[model samples]
Target chain A: MRIQSLCAALAILALAGCAADPAPTEQFRLTEQALEQAKAVGATDDVPELKLAEQKFTRAQGSMADQSFKNARMRAEQAELDARLAEARVLTQKSQEQLTALDARIIRLRKQLGEVQ
Target chain B: MSVFKKLGGGLLVLGCAGLFGCASQGSESALQQANSSFQSVKDDSNVLRNAPRDVIRAGESLARADRLSNYWGSGADVRHYAYLSQRYSEIAREHSNEAMNQERLAKLELERQRLQLALREAKLLSVQQQGKWLEEQIVSLATTETDRGLVMTLGDVLFDTGEADLKSSANRTVLKLVQFLQLNPKRVVRIEGYTDSTGARQDNLQLSRARAQAVADVLIDLGIDEKRIQVEGYGDEYPVEANASERGRAKNRRVEIVFSDEKGRLGAAR
Candidate 1:
């Protein structure tokens, strides 16, 4: 009877291992949107985070094709965050460039004011 | 035989547990790293203020990872949630940085505007201080008030020989003209160029026009409206003196600025 119970417990463990997670269609959509938004904000492939996001998103697509719902969801979720980080980084860089340009203009104005005075 | 089978089953369970324990070690460090990242961002008031939602998501993911770390054979799930939590924290930090930069940009833009205004006012004030004396000098230089209008003569010395570029010596006169135009916004001027009778007629005409354009360009650069100024080249045609002597030719090679009345009505072109 103990041997039978052990076999039954092993079978339950195997069943649990094979449990199918629901397809992460919503996650795939969210990942795609994040990538598109990053691109819209001028996040190019040169950005490391954007490149990572693209690579992971492609792998997530592969997982989806293989019906590995858990893998697909994890990869997609990470890719979404990576794309968002890329977008934020690009915007911050652009703002920094603007600040530099404005600073140069202010310096020039100050010099001109000095000359005027 | 039944004892042997039970021992084998027990060994199988031990082997599975050993495998999970090994995987859990790797995930344990990942959970720790993610928890630290989340803790840093969660405590940053700027991050909390700028990216409350992302911070909350990071905390939630870290909690989920922490819960999964306690479960046997859930290493993959624990690591996945840890990775997610770490990414959320990083994203939160970036968002806060961007927000702070935007705030600084706004403040810098305002400062730039204020400085620009101060510079403009300082320039106008300096010009006003020199305006009266410069006006007298200009009136004396442009003494010929013929039927054409009030005409000021810029002698050839203001430019290099055969070149249209005005020298630095012309800056004061140019600034005075700019100030005069700014003060009398309704007044317009026609800049006419004349050359000596020494060069070829075609070349002289082109040179005269280029010289006139150079002066007009300086006026435009100094903030005078292009519409208020007309340019013309009268190459050796209407000389103020004969081209018979060096003195006469020197007098003839000049640029004449014709000013309109205060009503913005320009005199008819020559």
Candidate 2:
């Protein structure tokens, strides 16, 4: 009975470890995807926050390499946020540039109309 | 002891059910948020066309999230797919905004070009009509449209014999000319006076000059700008007919008005 109880305890311990210590693979994937999203929007050209996001992603990779999954997950999550911010920034910048060009063209057209009149 | 075992089993079943319920709730919230984000931009044609792949990806991810939340009972996968759905939706929204802006800008550019063309055509039409009206008025006056310019005669009926003073009856003819000059302010005119060969040369010259000056003064009074009127006297120099006949002499005693070109400059052609 003592030996059987010991085996059961060991099995429970193994199950607990398996359930509690899963690697943050999904989080890492999410971070990678977010970074790709930022890149797809040309964040590298105008988004200053993209550099910070890259740094955080590199730190996440370092933590993952060291098997510090909790730390890696935290860094990856933060990197994802930074990447999302970079994407939004790039989108806003591009919109503003297009709007400014449109405004200039409108002004030029208005001046042409004035001359015609 | 059997009752206690039954109770323990029931509690375990209940606990598992509770855990599953919590996971389901979390998945539901994520799926809901993702679906709402997708719906927000679904109607945008720009999003549909320019970012078609992104929009489709978002829809597919949302569907997967819904399936995971409803059946798979894996909150992790549900949340992952839901997040992807929302992210792709964002990308679609961004591209859609850009496409819509481009379309609007193109429309504005076209509108401006159209308006400019319309204004130019209107101006051209107005100029053509103005030129036509001026030509018609000159024709109605029985004036000669010569290469030198328009020439209209104010006969000796406008002045008494051997006198430079204008009679009141002359005002009717002069008023017609004033109306014409007022309508075409850009055109300048020269007034030349002449007389029969019966009078002494110096007297005829002086009388002719006085008569031309009188007409010019009256034109100025009638609002024909003085700067546009030039007066000269020619005592029997250019005759329209022979001096020997009474009718020819009557015609020679005249004041001829010459209208200049658009620049108000009378050329030396006449």
Candidate number of the best DockQ? 1
In candidate 2, which residue pairs clash? none
> Which regions of candidate 2 are displaced past 4 Å?
A1-117, B1-22, B26-98, B104-108, B111-115, B145-149, B154-191, B195-231, B239-254, B259-270
Off by over 4 Å in 1: A1-18, B1-11, B139-183, B187-270
Interface root mean square deviation of every model, in Å? 2.1, 6.3
Query: Per-residue lDDT for B36-140 in model 2, tens only?
Result: 989977877767887888789889988887777764336766776787687778778776776677776678768767766766776676656766686676567
> In candidate 1, what are the lDDT values of residues B1-270, reduced to their tens digit?
889777877867886787588667889999999999999999999999999999999999999988977767678889889989998999999899889988988998999999999998997787666664666677886647879878888999998999999999988888878888887778899999999999899999999999999999999998899999999998888988989999999999999999898688788998
Q: In TM-score terms, which candidate is top?
A: 1
Candidate DockQ scores, in order:
0.51, 0.09
Q: Model 2: how far is A7 from its true place, Å?
A: 18
